[model samples]
Target: MKIGLYFGTFNPIHIGHLIIANHMVEYSDLDQIWMVVTPHNPLKKKDTLLDDYQRLYLVNLATEEYPKIKPSDVEFKLPQPNYTVNTLAYLQDKFRQHDFSLIMGEDNLKSLHKWKNYEVILQNHDIYIYPRVSPEIENLELKNHSKIHIIDAPIVEISSTFIRENIKSKKNIQPLLPCKVWEYIDHNNFYRK
Candidate 1:
């Protein structure tokens, strides 16, 4: 099984996220795309983030209908501030029968070197970079590497932070989120100030 791991905080899984994951399966060589819900991203600030399980639940709700996409809580059991190299290593070890690829945005390519054992990550797994409105990959070190596959997936300009702000201000986020996810947020009263 060839799987693409699309890791994110997923504060509330939105349609844009589903769009990218679905596109990965349809356009890329991977058989499945797993939305790896990160408990804590080493590079990001954790303040104001939703509980890991709630975020995971939202992701599950948003992705449940997509046969090609699935939600993963793999990072929940791992140590805090999980490193990509370690998570990838763990996944590779447990799923020996499956080939794993890292799914990321074009913007991440520029900061690859800042990641822990980033070189090892590149050496072991292929990286599928979906396009973002941000500037192109400026990191020339690995620009031409065969392991880096840059793909033009459909871009969604909206972000989770924007959705959270809108919710806090009592604005409707139906257009930004999947119906089920919006319903879940409504039921749970998430992201309110």
Candidate 2:
């Protein structure tokens, strides 16, 4: 099976996330995409973050309707301050029958070298980059981008941190998250400052 691994903290999954995953299946050769909910991202601050399981559950609830998209706790069981290289390594070992690809944003392209074992990850896996609004990849970058496929995904500015902070401030976040995720956040009284 060819799988696109779109890893994120999720915090709470939203429509923008779903759209990208759906687009991956519709436009790409990948059979399925596993929304690998990272328990901890090495680059992100965790002070405002919710419990990993709650975030994972929200991911599950938000993505339940899409057969090709799945919510995963794969990173939950992995080591702390999760890095892509490690997750990929673990997944490769566990699901030997499957081939994996990396799914990420265009901005991430500039920082790929900063990631752990980035060279190995780049060489071993196919990368699918969904473009953001800022810039287009130039030809020189294209040579480097050859190992990565760029797709123009819908650019919604919604962010999990923004949503979390909005909830804490008791601001309306109805437009940021899926209805089910919003309900879950409200029910759990999450982010109440």
Best by lDDT: 1
Candidate 1: list runs displaced more than 4 Å.
Answer: 41-46
Q: lDDT of each model, Cα atoms only?
A: 0.87, 0.83
Cα lDDT tens digits, model 1, 99-151, are 99999987888889899998899999999988887755654567688899888
Model 2: lDDT equals: 0.83
Against the true structure, candidate 2 reaches a TM-score of 0.90
- Flag regions of model 2 displaced more than 4 Å: 41-45, 139-144
Error of 2 at 122 (Å): 1.5
